[model samples]
Target: MAKTSWHELPRGVRDAVQRELGGVAGVEMISEGLSSDVTFVAETGLGRLFVKGARLDDDLKARQLRREISINPYVTHLSPEIRLQVEEAEWLIVGFDYVEGRRADYSPLSPDIPLVLDLLGELSETPCPEIPLRDAGRLRESHARPEDLHRFSGDALAHTDLNPGNFRITSDGRAYLVDWARYSRGAPWIDATAFAMCLMTCGHTPYDAEGIMAALPVWKTLEPGDLDAVAYYQSAMRSAWQPRLDPWTNASVAAARRWFDYRVGLEVGL
Candidate 1:
């Protein structure tokens, strides 16, 4: 998607956001991420803020933006704080505190994994917020085996998308999660499973990645059959949602295929 420049927004929308920021001194366009219609850094009298705006007319973007804003109020350092929401005309703009940090790396051997894992463990323990979120099984029902969907139910709030870019590591060496757009209510293990797949993208074999996450308490109760179902379901989903063939994407897809094939191979009598 193209970056919707600050000047492209309606006068009323821009004015509204300015008021919320106590008068915007200047605005810098943010050119990352596909979810936002207009993402920019606003230098305001109050301070610098990261603003992500989306036109309310685009149904999918609107729904994602609204869901993220709704969930923002409930999140702490787990995500950026929602300080202002400017709603006017066909636009809805949200401004968040801009954290000074860098994107997390998930390479074969990076110092970030331990901190990322700790964040995953802690976030999984967080109680689900009081909001309508995607139910795990139901989210994948059309593509998943019936038995696989059952593993998704639990009280934990899952940030289902674990792209390294969504994680921010501050100068103090603390990590914070960003982008609650795909936040959902599910079992704690759901997020871990997603990260387990991510670990594979970082070059860990499926079994080895699973071992890395064995520190999570859910492992004590998780069954191999349960993992089998999840793997099949994810493999199917990946097969359906095609991405542009770049090195990273190809590598990610290959990892998914390898994991799926490995798990499926283990199901001897099924």
Candidate 2:
């Protein structure tokens, strides 16, 4: 989606942002994330802050924004600190302490792999905050068979989207996961499996990705045939996304199928 420029905002909304930031010296629009209509890094008199917003009337984006705000406190240690949020002229905008980091590399031998896995290990054990979060099964219902949904059942707070773009690696070797709009309550292993899918996309084989994750406690708790069920669920999701033809969807479908095929081979003792 094309990003909305800082100048494109209504004067009142811009004023609200400026007031919240004390004063803005410069603004750089960010185009990576899809949920926000306006995403930018503003150089304010106080400091640079990453900000994003959408029209209040867009129910989907509005809800996603709200979810991010609500989840921020709970996941602060794993994400940038939220510093500003204001609603004006029908637009709701939010700001966060600008993070100094690069997009995470999920390649087979990237040192980032360990940092990301360690972050996921912490996330798997982090208790779910008392907030309304969709159940993992329900979130995947349209793309997965009902019988297999049971495999995703649990109370662990899962970051459903594990795309490399959602991870940031700092110069000091710290890793952070961003975009909590789709976080769900699910089996602790869900995020690890999602990470494995991303690893495969970056050239790791199914066995290698799963083997690396095996060091996490979540992986050790998987019941027999659990991974096969996850594979089936993921393959079904790929089929559902096939018609989209978007680059992300296409790449994800291809990666998902590789793991799915490997699981099928395991089932047949190939």
The best candidate by TM-score is 2
Model 1: colliding residue pairs: none
- Give the Cα lDDT of each candidate: 0.82, 0.87
Off by over 4 Å in 2: 243-247
Candidate 2 lDDT over residue span 1-270, tens digit each: 677799999999988888878999999888877899899999986598999998899999989999999999999888888899999999999998888899999887899999998998889878998998889877778777677888788889988888888888899999988888888898889898888888887888899989998988888878898888888888887867636756667777888898899999988999
TM-score of 1: 0.93
- Per-model TM-score versus the true fold: 0.93, 0.95
RMSD of 2: 1.5
Tens-place lDDT digits, model 1, residues 1-270: 687899988899888887777899898887997888889888897788898878888888888888888888767757778788888989988888889999988776788888888887778667787888888777878878876687777677888889888999887877889988888877668888888888898789887888888987756667657777777877777767777755666667778888889987777633
> Candidate 1: worst 10 consecutive residues by lDDT?
217-226
